[model samples]
Target: MKVIAVANQKGGCGKTTTAINLAACLGKKEQRVLLLDLDPQGHCSLGFGVFNEDARDLYDVFTGEAVLEDIILPDVFTGVDVVPATKTLQAAENLPVRRDERDRLLAKYLMPIRDRYDYVVIDCPPSMGLLCFNALAAADLVLIPIEMSLFGMHGIDRMYDVVRELRERHGRDIPVRVLPTLVDSRTRLCRQFLREIGERFADDVLPVMVQFTVRLKEAARQGLPVIAFDPTSTVAVQYGRLANETMSMLQDDAATDGVGEPATGLPEATAAVQHNNPANEAVPVLQSHATPGGMEESRKRLGTMKRVFEEARSRLSRQGGLQKVVLRFYDFTGRDVKLAGSFNDWRPDQGVVTRTANGIVEKIVMLMPGTYQYRLVVDGLWQEDPSNPEQVSNYSGGYNSVLQVEEEHATEHA
Candidate 1:
């Protein structure tokens, strides 16, 4: 089975949302997906409508008190299974030295029944703690979710550093990729930052983007993924695309290895990543290194970085937020065009539907810098936006169009 960890050192970057939805989307494709929620907050269980926590969970699994087989539950969705977490998992942080063993524990537990599922997706906590390390240790691929924010950008460097540290210690270079979330195209700053990220991460960034959408929050409230809640929503479709991209990447890796799988042990997979990178840091430096300027200097640098991030947040906040956005749909000859989304609480009838020149349909509204999922109702028939390529499965036999209202001068469309 391929292990993919959805992780980021930054909180609220859509990590849990991505983890749950991606697994659900993969399940929709008939791929057996097991989502291990290493997050102490236990959002996965909540997503699945399981309010009652199991007395035994990942805490037991990690502490060797319970077996994974016994703890694994499939109540989340049809083809997706989940190993939920609880507050007790926080105890993992206090795990002692020789931590690489703890890191490797996930891999060890997963090895026995690894082939049962096609993929094991782990939702890691938003910290560089032991739990995150364990997830990284077992992962074949690390997917980092980054919101379009100042703090989000700063965490990327720290996340990279953690990956490199793993590479140096384990002699296996873990491949990490960034997935931009909550991307608002309406903001000039958001758009420009995205461009900068594309230039910097380049091949390391996933092609699919998740727009800021309240449907994600709604789905959680309904105890379902957006794909299940609104199968035709744009965010759901984007998750589907993300799953396909990940599968394709793995397929290519297997072919490259010529061994029918990404070379057996962790070292081989890491080495493959190491060999594949041309633009990233080279191999020699990937080796173990001494602490640069000792612990005190590292602490001082971290303080400086914190201050820098604060300044960045202040600067970016000014450049982002609510703006006048125009939602337009073109080339529609339908009777009336209505819009429904979270902005209007998904009320189809109350939306202002107007017909513009050249058969162009449009709705002008002020929106903040975030992702939103909306669909056009053309003559009483709900449809995905023709002009907007960003969409997700609404699970209602249709699709909801995605719109990113960036924090720019305005006039952005979905």
Candidate 2:
């Protein structure tokens, strides 16, 4: 099953809306989908016409008082199930366990039903607390809903730091993709921000942006996903495009391994691509190393490097929350290295890996609390870091290493 969490630290970013609509679209396409409302507001449940004053909700699951089968309720729309939310979610902060343990609560609950649905979409609250951490820990991928405002970028660095910490410490490899939502094409600032994000994120950015539209509100007011409420609307069309793109990515990811199943409900050609295509070979690895100044260096890098910046937790009395995971590349000869990847637009200079005092090349990056897969760029070549033992070969035959950050309550909560 593919579990996706729609999250954003900044409020009013359309995170809940995306979760509701995206689940609806997937269901409309005949795919089995489950929408888990992690937000205390329970907007997702209300959007699907399943609100009840005394319903058993996600809170039951978190505390182990209920199982998924008991809380799941059919929505007005067919093929979609919802696990509603209640005010109890707000109490997560007060749980007796350590903070990191709270993040694993959702994962423990979902473990039982992981394979029941084709897609599990989680709608997260607007803070980096136990609730959001639980959603992140339970998710296979994270969809960050970014608004077109200047402050939109404010907490993103912190989010990245959390993701990195989760991966390096926990060994979870969750991939995160950013989605541009509530975009106002008319505003120059919005347009500029979109362009900058596109240039900065490149392929990591989704092809379709959710434009600011009245229809979105209309659909919400009508208590239906945008696709069902108005399949012909612009927002609906954009959502469809996003769904298709997401399916394509999953299929591509599966092809490298003999594992991933083809996406149902797509055209024959699309399905073919989604399935294994021997013709599509993995790209060659790049060369990377670190320099003396702690910067990462990549040799023969051809694209722009996308850097995901995040905030470092404060260290009032004890050691700081966690240090950033540094990515450095070294040549076979142990010389300084360069870096390249989907984030860096494959450009060598984007993330220059610097050498260390002990002759090690490295670059430090702050990632959010999740798992991340990356490779190194050596002298004009791309390859896995021999210094690190955790590596996996993608379907493309390229090597990738997994890094995990421990959620505040991962162990205690689990």
Candidate 3:
């Protein structure tokens, strides 16, 4: 099975939101998906519409009090199963001391049922504790959500260090991708931050951006993913796209011996290649969903809406209501660093500072009124902030970069 841990040291960076929506979208495509809620807050479980206050959850499974089969529940979305979380999980902070094989607890629990699902998505708690470590240890890949802000950049270096250490010590080489969440493209600062991420990370970044939308908040309030609540919304569409990309990546990995190969082979030569291709290979066809006469009109309308949104946002930014934050990094450790969070598209970027003049690399960014989480890019690293005292750690023992914006500025923008 392809396992992914959705982890972000900073809270409210849309980690649970992405996990719920991505899983739901994958399920809609007829993929068997298992979502594990490793967070004590149980936001992911609630997002799946599963509310059992006393449910036996990850806490029980990790503590050896319950089996995986007993905790797994079918979600409202077809082909999706969930291991819900409960308040008892808050005590999981102390689980490492109680168990001899604490770090591999989650991996051991999931191994038995690995073949049962096509994808296993874990929603990790915001803190870097034993629970988060277990999730990372179990995962073949990791997705980090970063909030686009100066502080967000500060946290990525530490996370990278942890991931690197795990790979080296545990022999678990997990590929990680950083994703930007809650993006507001209208802000120049947001756009600049994205551009910087792209310049730094290069091919490690995903092409899609999950824009900030009110529909996301509404879905959260309704205890559902945007895809389940409003499939027509932009957020839902973007999540669906993300699911498709993830599935494609998994399939590619499987085909290349990353997993195992399919068991059917009738031909051993060029005929097998020909059998996979058809006459359509050499021809390009245009597919259109719009009526011939209405296509141009629809395009014009979309253009108008885009211009209107940009105009309004520009006005707001110019009124001193919101300031842009640009984060730049130079990795001095001679390794690649990935900047992940709610800001960039959750892909690895060059934000790594390989050569520095004064023994320190820096990034500057402008942010509007709000709180955000981010991490640094060290020699191909992902880490949290070390200098900030208000920093919070994730369940994986990684720190988070945090930023708090002024309320007055937020109101002015509104």
Candidate 4:
């Protein structure tokens, strides 16, 4: 199984949001996903509408009160399962290891049963403590979610430095992905920061950007992922796209590191892995999702990618409140045309592209003056707008047409 840890020392960077939504979306894709909540706040457990006041948290498993298997809440959402965290886990800060190996606690427990799922995503706390160390030790990839703010880069630089230091000290080598979170592209600052981040991280920066939305908060408050709360929302679609990109990253990692890279730092366990206790032996044999030699090619393609963001285009004028632009599809003869993009939560069904009198697929999208990215679901095949010259990579191995909505005054004045 591929393991990912969503971590950031600074809180409110969409770390938990990314972890929760990505897991839920991956589960919806028929992948067996396991979410491990290591944060003391228990936000993940609460977000999923799951409550276990008397249930065992990760603390119990670490203290030997319960095995990891006994605590897994299976089928929490479709194909997803969870290992919830309680407020009691805050005590991990003071917990001491029997030996000097403080970081091996989580790796020891996860080693046995990790093979049961396709992905094991850990939601880490907002500090650099034993909990974060444990997650770092167990993860194959470290996803650093950054909010779209001026201070975003500084935090990422610090986190990246921490990961590098940890790898050197503990001998664990894990990949890191910089994901831009809660982006508001209407502002020039947001656009500039995205361009700067992509330039700074190169291939390490994920192509997907999670936009800021009230629906995400509403979904969390309602005890469900945004996708579950409102699948028609663009934020849901972005999370789904993030999941696929993450899966692709792992599939690539597996091909590059064939024998499957062991959980770094724990030497004895890695050597004696085949001889785990009988009870834990029932855990199925681990298998990789990537074919041999595929990761190298994927890596090359990823590394060669430049931060070519789509520049928006304005063809039509705006009305009072919302800018109205008629999207015209010249070559589509499909039965249905659905427009899904940054604007409409990637729900093609919500905004249907009609066949106009001009003998082509056409539809009017009334959006506030701003920039957005979208694609047409023509006969279920996702296609970029053919007539639109401005397009950019979606970072999940696809393209999205960039659109700019300007107010009538702005258009007329220009």
Candidates by TM-score, descending order: 3, 1, 4, 2
- How do the residues 1-414 of candidate 1 rate in per-residue lDDT, one tens digit apiece? 778899976557899999998888889889988998888789888887774565467778767788888888874687898988887786766655363375677777787667778888899876566778778867768899888765456446756777776666665546777888987767765675566566456457666778888999999999998988998987887887888777767655542311022243345423343223212322231122223355676566556545654455556547554466677666675468778764555677453445487666668754546556677777888888878776544424365676765556776564
- Rank candidates, lDDT, best first: 4, 1, 3, 2
State model 4's lDDT. Answer: 0.70
- Model 1 TM-score on a 0 to 1 scale: 0.65
**Per-residue C-alpha lDDT of model 3 across residues 1-414, encoded as one tens digit per residue:** 888788876666788999998889889989999998998888887886677898898778767888898888975577899988887886776755544466677777777887889898899887667788778777666778766543344345556667765565564355666677778877776665565455333333455557788898888789788877898987788888778766766565553211232124322211111011111221011111233235576466445534544454466668765555444343344445455554433444422222244544444334455555667656656776555455555545566676565545332110
Indicate the residue-level lDDT of 40 in model 3: 83
Better of 1 and 2 by lDDT: 1
Per-model TM against the reference: 0.65, 0.62, 0.65, 0.62
Task: Give candidate 2's whole-model lDDT.
Answer: 0.62
Error (Å) of candidate 1 at residue 80 is 0.7
Tell me how far candidate 4 lies from the true structure as C-alpha RMSD in angstroms.
18.8
What are the per-residue Cα lDDT tens digits for candidate 4 across 1-414?
877899976557788898999999999989999999998788888889997777788999988999999999999997889999988887775676754466668877876775788888899986666788778767778899977753344345556766775566666566787788879988775776676566456556666778899999999999899899999898998888888778876876562221143445632211111221212222121111223235575465334322222122121122154455677766656467788865555677564435455557677665555456678887889988777786554323356677766645332111
